[model samples]
Target: MSKRYIITGAPGTGKSSLLLQLQKEGIHCFSELSRKVIQHQQKLKGNKTPWGDILGFAELIYQKTIEELKSPVNEISFVDRGLADMTAYLTSQSYFIPGYLQHFPYKKYYKNTVFLLPPWKEIYVNDPQRPQTFKEAMQIHEHLIKTYKNLSFNIETLPKTTLTKRKEIILSLI
Candidate 1:
């Protein structure tokens, strides 16, 4: 089986940038599910959004993750986010994490060491898609670390540096 790696952390932490850079380098990668859902919802004016229905959004991302994880591949694949991310967001929102996800075997689906990108205040910006404040971003970061640790994952925090340097760190670790 091909090794599965996940890059997860708070929003605006450059997860997407790093993933895109890795993809350009010919690495197999899965896009961030939550952002896709958000874009689609905005286009359709749908109620399944983080601002409207967080659980619904979480469910959508969880399903998307399952689908991507099912595909057959020879080389190692990197996922932008995983179940732990969804669960953390849900918990942060005061939503009850589904039992199915609470007991899901995270180690079986993702690599033991998960790369967590910390929030970069210098580069952080608020866009339509990412409206969380800096404080909120930090909270999300803490939650992500807690969630991963609860799952027994080896959390590897990425350095606070330029996008290029961040990409190098991930590539070297992988």
Candidate 2:
């Protein structure tokens, strides 16, 4: 059986860092769709940014996420984020969840093993793509936890610690 894991949490919570550490150990991994969409939109100077065409951005992320999930998993493939993130982002934006995403079968494609790294103000930074304040990230974090739980995912919150411990915890699950 394919074992897929998701590392999701607030922005700048080291999801990518944890995934990178696992990748270095020769594990299969998938990039986060939000970051990928952000970089792509920024390069084109498009309006599909977090502050701009958010609906469009969410749609793109949904599409990309499905495609990534469809890829045949060999051993362990860690997805930096999952479809539940779309709902959290939309909720944070005060927008109603769209019908398309509301009906998406997230549990079907995703594994029950989900690691949510809570907000870490010490490591938080706002860059071109990550413009949310630390406080906003924390708020987002709560929504994410709620989203994953509502979906019946088994959430394992990653404590603020070293990457080695994070990887070890996730590997132990497998």
Worst 10 residues of 1 by lDDT: 68-77
Give the residue spans of candidate 1 off by over 4 A.
none
Q: What is the number of backbone collisions in each predicted candidate, taken in the order shown?
A: 0, 0
lDDT of 2 by residue, 21-134 (tens): 999999998888888899999999887877789899988987787677778987678888888888998898799999878888776777887999999989899998999999
Residue 147, model 1, lDDT: 93
Whole-model lDDT, candidate 1? Answer: 0.85
Weakest 10 consecutive residues of candidate 2 by summed lDDT: 104-113
C-alpha lDDT of residue 79 in model 2: 89
Residue pairs in collision within model 2: none
TM per candidate comes to: 0.94, 0.95
Candidate 1 structure quality by residue, lDDT tens digits, 1-174: 676888998989889998888888888888888888999989999878777888888788878877877887546678888878988888777889987688877887788989999989987898877889999999889889989999888888999887788888888887
